[model samples]
Target: MPLAHPFDDDKLKEECGIFGAVGVADAANFVALGLHALQHRGQEAGGIVVHDPVHGFNSARRMGYVRDNFTSHEVMQTLPGNVGIGHVRYSTAGNKGQTAIRDVQPFFGEFSMGGAAIAHNGNITNADALRRELIERGSIFQSSSDSECIIHLMARSMGRTIPDRMEEALRKVEGAFSVVAMTRTKLIGVRDPLGVRPLVLGKFGDGYMLASETCALDIVGAEFIREVEPGEMVVISAKSGVQSHFPFRRRQSRFCIFEHVYFSRPDSILGGRSVYETRENIGRELAKESPVEADLVCPVPDSGTPAAIGFSLQSGIPYAMGIIRNQYMGRTFIEPSEQIRNMGVRLKLNVNRALIRNKRIILVDDSVVRGTTSRKIKDMLLDAGAAEVHFRIASPPTAWPCFYGVDTPQREKLLAATMTEDEMRDHLGVDSLKFISLDGLYRAVGEAEGRDPKAPKYCDACFSGEYPVAPTDMIEKGFQLKAAE
Candidate 1:
């Protein structure tokens, strides 16, 4: 399979996707479908752990796409269970190699309570410190993933029950996490205090479902049963049905705003709003915030399409297919070298010469990261005889790297972290460039009055650099924080 999509190399990457099902017939099969729907969240590897009363626990983890690895009857037959949890991984904490498979998740730990399998969907910012502490105490780690810290923590907990152990484990951990886990009879789900990542509860017939997004629930024909509230844990089993526990100190929810911007699939619903509609609203906000005269408003394609349409309607510029993307290409194209990444863009996206010849174009994209892709696209448009290239970005400048779940470039590597709008425009050789203001983004995402200076509605750390969760590990490791440029 292709390593990554050319256009996506410049985007923030979500670390993983998690799904769990309890009291379902062919539980692994339903979990597989849920993971397939959430495939956009992570593509590196996929795994599922199921528990059968007769056979105990069974697991299968493999590198590459879910369809290639998990869709077979042979694989499904082995995972015979009524309760299961699954994970699709994209590495954020570990190095890439043969050993990387060891980090492939739905990481199983045989606790004294019982065998508990977990699929975690966010980063644990203080994991390094926790890992060291655990290791020094004779805890043997099986993988390099930061998520394994939870397993070890749970193992050491004195709680008599599995859920109690899990709650005790989470209370000591720090940072964004949405976790789905399973024991022989119960499936459990939890979101961090900030709700930095998403976890939703769903129901299908007598079974219960838990996933990162509503789209996954739709795939399994599950009814949306509200989100697993932040700092709350839900345990589902045949006997208990569903039990809810608020185990952490209550805090204001800080859902990752980037979920609407780029990470989530357009069809998914987040924060009670359709992701596609939210994106269109973002485009409308972008148009109102930064209007420009142009022959056409052209999207970067796929991720940028919804916003581009909204921009076209609001700006009165006809939308055109100026850049065509290779439909077969994956969301990410992992180039081993810079030389290949530079050329991969051309292979993935081709300028529509007939539509763009001598036309003034407004390029609408989600966000500009390193600016390398933007620069290449500008060159491509100029080469295709475009009279002018103006850029209208849907979100505010990404000035900080995410320590939550997203794999963001360091501060220095982020173009917005160092360069002014004019500087970026000059660097990309664009006629004009503008990004929607932070307040405007809030308005688009349904906060009509804009972001509250004191208590923001969502996590805008990547743009405003106001991190809800402290990067404790990074600070301890001597990573300096610079003011937003």
Candidate 2:
């Protein structure tokens, strides 16, 4: 995860998800782009590893944007055959690594039992304790990522097959997780018992695919099949076809709502909810929840557009594109260091003075991670002649850092955790700021019922602090050792 690059945390990060497949012809490239579609979920590093059932596993992991990381021809050349998985990462200081590529996704392991590459999405709250338990048994780790702890658990499990060991290992690990692994001959996918992250299955001609979001399927031209049911274990191979293991509580399917609010692409469908529609619903509810007096409802660009449209429809406020986002700019501006990230923000967003001049502008955005970009965007609006700049976030303040696969910040890095809402408004220099109430957000996303089979109640612990799984203290120190480059 880019060796836990030092920089200010921005809007609550989607922190990159992953995608994979088995039996597809163009496996490597398809998975690469699938990861790219998930770039919004993460931006630090990206990689893919392909396994030939007849041969061995070949991995190409690099630390950079998808484009940069996969640029090396070797990444493609090394992936010899079909059946593969890919990952994009945004691990913080604690998850970043030094020379050990073990921290990289598709973490490979060979411990007398067998060898496999694991691709993970979501954090494991009990990671620290799990690591300590394994360490006490003289388990030596090649990486510090809490995700790698799973491999060790598998090694110790008394199961005969990889799937058995995997399922057994998973039973012992606690916290939110959705994972995909590739063995020498098979593909394995599993979601946490509580299902706090999103994972789905896709079909490409005769081949089967799985990814964090459906956008990956469209990019790869894979046929939309269905979502991997929460609390399900799917093992796919030519011999076994696709087998399922529903080892968890059926009521435990709690898909992360923030994925719809900010992380996924608008076109993507996360757990049957369209990202665009869900976000719009949030905006619509915002208007109903807290109507505001404003001249124009201006979105912060990209993510806020759909929500702004909903705001306009509900409140009769004119929605205008008051901010222009420079989509052409590479996520990695690449000058020298973190200070340059702020410079990238200027290049990325420009305020429209004509629209905001002397107007009471309400700026809508998805979520605020560190309040860095919000502060800058607000200053941009005020400087562009905004009279009363009001900031409205479509989602609630990210009060908690995700420990699972999502690239969550530390307790110290979360703006909401560190500062009060009133202090945040002052910090960002916005005349007003308000987050969608947790209840309002739930209703907007059709989660208030918590009865839908596909859309069961989820863990909004990041918001409400009611953890679904009994978490161990490992996650508190998961980042203490850091991930790899």
Candidate 3:
């Protein structure tokens, strides 16, 4: 299978997204709608599991987009129930490029208390060690996914109920996670103690829902309730309504700050802040940090539009759509020859030559990972007759790989890991390139005095390299951390 969309291969890949609901009739239908809204988070595979009084537990998983697989009447009809949970996956853990149907989630397992299905949205950093231990103790794994470890862990638990078993199962696992699980009578949601991933609670008609973002909740007409707190677990049923608990040890919440910059839907609300507004704030901060003179301020495309607007507003320059994206372009199934492959970003994006010709352009983008796409985009603009091109990035340089669910290449592959900012600009052949500082990024995300050196409010490990949790699996594999100054 093709690994990732050619245009997207240069960026950090989102891990997964999950949605669950209880006490609603035909819950699978709502789940499909929610997953459709969250399709951007993961496009490789999708699955849904539902529990009915008559049918017990039923599931349908497929290796494709939610719209292609879950929207069909034939697939939805098979998963008949009033309670359901769904997951869309991009495979951060096991079988990365070739995602098997077995690796698709909402993994189901039979237990003494009954059966339960779980959809996890973050990477379990300790999964390798746990998998080795579980296999030694006689646990049979059905899939290559690290998420399957949770099911095996639950089966071995001596707890009395499914929730208790799940709590027991998660205590031994480490790293970032936002999980949505289902038992016969309950819909459950839990976030890791640091809250590295996003999960929200919403109220629907007489029922409740949990999702990776508020945008999913809006897709099904669910009222926004609140974010599931860091380290908090909420169990919902028709009888009990919603019961909350603290299942993990208390620690300072370290929600991933990159969610504000890129991962989340622009319309979604996260951590009581508008994601779109925060992106705009990052642009304003970028302008303050690096002032430049240019004839036109242009965004690279859809992801850069909001920040470009903010940059234009702050600099009093006119914002223009210098680059246009082909919204209809989908993945190509057949392998292309060298000529077609060389087309690269041209297949997905085109320059608005009429407006940008002979103009000094300021290009606003979210972040630069490997600089491959940046070089291509700059070349495209220059070929379109732009006199000068400058890049204004919305986030700091990503110098470290994220172990908390986001799919990043090795440290050696990251451009920032090896090059200085000026060197990166020269390598990309741009007139100038500047990124927002870590302090500016924190300020844009509502940390007024900027990031605290002692106790940061959010996880900026990819930029600062101050990992909140040591990556146990990587350490075992001989990965090194940043040296102390």
Candidate 4:
């Protein structure tokens, strides 16, 4: 067998998640809970903004997991508003160049139309072009986020009202996105024409809400109404209730498949498919594609567990947790300098020497971007006396940074963008490595659907380099030459 570099086990998280709710007595508190449910989508930072009819507005944003950052009683007490929105961000548009408070969301803006707070989950690839146009027209920008570009475009468009201007601004931009904006009055929800991201409508008795995933709705006791139609916008207000509009009709619907495979919480329902079921299907598919007679089948850690179960069942191999993740690993941990930034990956995960020693192990993980973390994991397994470590990636290699809000490494840095599968195996020092084909992945997640809710056809551009939207300057600059589909 040809030995190439293999994928690492400590994969860097790149997807971002968002949530919004209104008409609830404690919208701010409700959103905080929702954000906690969607926390797995991001870990770098989290924030929530509430609009008070009489008290103007209050917002809170801090770096870390949603549970630690926004769900605290101290933090919730400070945010008081009946309408609110929250965000968990990963830098697809802007790296952590300026991790200042200004860059955080909901990116509150005070404009002539009104004070608006926005939280977004996808990237606007055309943001750079739009921002340059707005800059020429004398618009000052606060952050490098492509999300701000939408707001600038909204201000320039001569729409009669906030909703009209928002629709106009969305037209000028292109790419995968699901956004929730709170103007002084109504809470607005928008999905890109391609529906590259997810947006759902939910209800909580006298109030209604919109969130990135149904899991968020479950946290706050809001019953899921339905998946918001692709290329559609829904506005919720005290006077109008829930109003839906399709600013731009799309011939096809294409939501990101990674949400079910990796981005969403295991229990969440996205694109009408259960994330857990989709993951389980991935394992079933993996077993069929490349079944290995091993002593045991084990997942890298948390994310890959469900698929691991399916793999074990289909292949008839015993499933085990050969690796232990230190869930307490803080958001930011550095000894002192940038020289050892990747060191934390090891601290975050360790091998179960007792379980792995002298065993032929199959390690199934979600995806591999940079191979640095994987190399360490392989070494850890080797040191623990594993007889052999065969690796399998549940998804195809990620060759592109998700312009729709997922913060991944620049193109050149993405191992799959430059290296072939064999080359990657050699780098990561594994006995063998295989990635699930895109077709195999599609069937895995697709077969999991039962009925009722409609599902988008799925955009697999990160693994395929087939972006549904064109990238903006910041996206181009941030991701570099290898970033395209």
**Best model per lDDT:** 3
lDDT (10s digit) by residue, model 2, range 28-83: 87888888888877666777878775667788877767876665576687787678
The models' CA-based lDDT, in order, is 0.90, 0.77, 0.92, 0.78
Query: Which of candidates 1 and 2 reaches a greater TM-score?
Result: 1
Pairs in clash, predicted candidate 3: none
Off by over 4 Å in 2: 1-8, 71-74, 93-100, 111-114, 249-251, 336-344, 410-413, 418-420, 448-456, 474-485
The 10 consecutive residues of candidate 2 with the worst lDDT sum are 476-485
What does candidate 4's lDDT look like per residue over 189-289, in tens digits?
A: 99888887788889887788888889889988899999888889998986779998899966577777777787778888876678898899899898898
C-alpha lDDT of candidate 3 relative to the true structure: 0.92
Q: Compared with the true structure, what per-residue lDDT tens digits does model 1 show for residues 235-330?
A: 998777899989999999999999989999999999899999999999999999999999999999888999999999998899999999988766
Candidate structures ordered by lDDT, highest first: 3, 1, 4, 2
Q: Could you tally the backbone clashes for each prediction? A: 5, 22, 0, 20
- Of the two candidates 2 and 3, the one with more favorable TM-score, higher being better, is 3
Model 1 residue 402 distance off true place after TM-score fit, in angstroms: 0.5
Misplaced by over 4 Å in model 4 are: 1-12, 69-75, 92-94, 111-113, 332-345, 447-456, 472-485
By summed lDDT, which 10 consecutive residues of candidate 4 come out lowest? 1-10
- What's the true lDDT of residue 200 in model 2? 87
Tell me the TM-score of model 2.
0.89
TM-score of 1: 0.96
Per-residue lDDT tens digits for candidate 3, residues 1-485, read 33467667787878799999999999999999999999888988889999999988999988777887887788888999989999998866345577888888999988877889999998888999999999999998888788899999999899999999999999999999999999998999999999999999999988999999999999999999999999999999978899999989999999999999999999999999999999999999999999899999999888888899999999998999999998866553346667877898998899999999999999999999999999999999999999999999999999999999898988988999999999999999999999999999999999999999899999999999999999999999999998887
Estimated TM-score for each candidate = 0.96, 0.89, 0.98, 0.89
